[model samples]
Target: MIWLLLLLSAILGAIAFVAGRRLATRRAVGQSAHSRPGYHGAYAMIWALAPALLVVIVLLVFGGPVKNTMMESGSPAAVSALEPFEREAFLADAERVAAGAEPLQIWEGELAPALRSEGARAHRIESTISGAGVLAVVLLGLLGGLIALSRLRPNLRARNRVEGWIFGLLFACAAVAIITTIGIIASLAWDSFRFFQAVPIAEFLFGTQWSPQIAIRADQVGSSGAFGAVPLFAGTFLIMLIAMAVAAPIGLMSAIYLSEYAGSLTRAVVKPVLEVLAGVPTVVYGFFAALTVGPTLRVAFNDLGALLAGGPLDGIGQYLMLVQNQMALTAGGVMGIMLIPFVSSLSDDILNAVPQSLRDGSYAMGATQSETIARVLMPAALPGVAGALLLAVSRAIGETMIVTMAAGLAANLTLNPLDTVTTVTVQIVTLLTGDQEFDSAKTLSAFGLGLTLFAATLVLNIVAQRIVKAYREQYD
Candidate 1:
């Protein structure tokens, strides 16, 4: 029915457009016109379509609630007498039956007859509402089209008015994005506040432990759930640092070589191949880390450890032999591999964007390609390169699948990349994995972790932006 109304609205708008253009042509037969006939046609189309669309939107938003109210008002006594949850279930079943679907659950206490009565009433109510909605659409479209036609004249600035509408539409899209971001932050903060009420902020922020397993029942044996997030933070940073260490130099150098030295054929082939890494799924990297890299590192280190045992570097040997399959290093390395394309692509673009005049000046000064890149081009592109690196860092911090599959879920606080560690994102997923009540600290703590992660990332971005702005000011 909604789709049908939309088609009718489009047809009516087309008719209005044709009528408006014809009238404008007649009016401008001997006189100058402010706007073209096409503009007048578009103006009429907007009037016809906008009003009808507004009506349809109102129906879509309020139609369900109004129908539900009608059902509740006419609900059988048996349904009203049920508890709140049960009453909602009964109404849902009646709605299902109204749609010719069987009730999901059996009912008692004369509810069966009540269900049929309410169902039939619901069907009739929906039919009436849909019929009224169609009528309203047609009436509104006709009225708006008539008013638009009557207002049409050689002096009407229809083009400007249409442009105003388009500008308003663009502004509305931007406003929606801003509003959505604010809403997400508000929800995270509110839930995080509730969690902080249950767990002390000082402990959560400063304490070293992060065991967040709260007891389900009062009498249950449980750990009381330590919400200290230091371990998670440490794990997150350790992995990110390792990833950046691997990705930054290699990715940057690859960008430099490709941008400054590679021939067009080589650049065309190599750049695409490197970027294909970005398209590879993170899970595949996780599998590679777990199955190939992790065991290889462990075995290689263990063999070296065996050779060093009872020797001068016995302690180092033991530590090396203790390397595990699921470690921060494995996840970080694979994540770095995954991040190569982002760094390379962004840096390549930024470097290429540097004015060729800079390169020519360096060459005129007898500077070689390496010297030119190191001194002139790099400094100019630093702001964009920094931004790209920060973007990659944010990506690394938010990653979950790679960490979950490669790094074990042990919230260890140590800095050793070879040890099993878990990030805040991994813990957030673990905390909210199964069926659980939301009010508990255990569940709410996911929001806390999320909020903290958000704040950290936000701060990182602000710092990066400042750095970019400060450096960019000089160049600008």
Candidate 2:
């Protein structure tokens, strides 16, 4: 259905484009005041597309909730958790009555008519929006085209005005992406606020414990759920540190090799191969970390005397030992591997983007490639490299699957990399993955963690940008 709608919209836009052009051509040859044939075409295209697109937006926003409410309100269980045969008979009778036939079927046919009527009404409403939109576009296009054509005289200028409108439209389109990001952040903040209301902000921010199991029955026994976020935060930081430790050097080295050393042919092959890493699924990485890397590390660590000869390594081992099996080191290692391509690609771009003249000037001073790169290129690219590192750190912090699968679920409020720990992202996923009361502190705790994560990332980004600006000014 969505594809069909998109196809129709594209077709309508093309038609509007052609129609607008034809109308413009028919007017005085060089006459246009506010816009040209192309501008009019685009204006018409927007009009043609807006209505159907709005319909889609409205439908998506309300459709699921409305449908769920409708289905729930009609209590199927109350009627009977009926036997299959009985349900079939009921449906059959309903269909007969709905068709206005004699009551030969088991279910009432009146329900069928009602459903059909509602479906028809929805279709009519959608069709009306589409039809009106298309008509409005055609009319507006014709009027605008005529006015533009009339104003386009030998001495009159239309191109500048047309360009201004074009720029405005392009700017608005670009702003949509930024606006969407802001909207998402706002939503996260709102949810986090709700979470803080349920759990004391202090406990969430500074508490050392981290469990989130609620009783399923009145007599079920378990530890009281802990809302302290320290463990998750510690786990996340541990993993992030490990990941950055791995990714940073590898990526920076790769970037240096690519920008300063690799031949064009080598770059052509190597760059794409490196990029393929980014496309690999996080789930694939998770499985690799959990099933392969985690066990391998355990065995290796045990051999190296990190674990006792006969003891099973359990939960966050850094500062606390609550659950066994999570090793922050493993999760962090895999996460770093996952982040390598992200850092390498970005660093490569910045390295390459460093002005050629800087290198030339160094070479002119009889500096070798290595020395020129070290003294000039590295300094020049430092700002961009710092930005890339910050970006990598942000990504590592928010990463979910590998840490969740390999890092262990137990939050350990410690900084040791060897200890198994959970992160805010991992906790959020664990907390909300299944059925839960929305009002519960456990659920709200996820929001609190999310809010903290947001603030941390925001601060990091600001700091990175400021550092980059300062670096750039130094070079200038």
RMSD of each: 2.9, 6.9
Alpha carbon RMSD to native, model 1: 2.9
lDDT of each: 0.91, 0.71
| TM per candidate | 0.90, 0.74
Per-residue lDDT tens digits for candidate 2, residues 148-256, read 4444343333455556667887999889988998898888788888877767788777888776677666555324566777777777788899999999999999999
**Against the true structure, whose TM-score is highest?**
1
lDDT of 1 by residue, 91-131 (tens): 88988999999999998769978889888998999999999
> Would you give me the overall lDDT of model 1?
0.91
What does candidate 2 score on TM? 0.74
In model 1, the runs with Cα more than 4 Å from the true position are 106-109, 215-222, 473-476
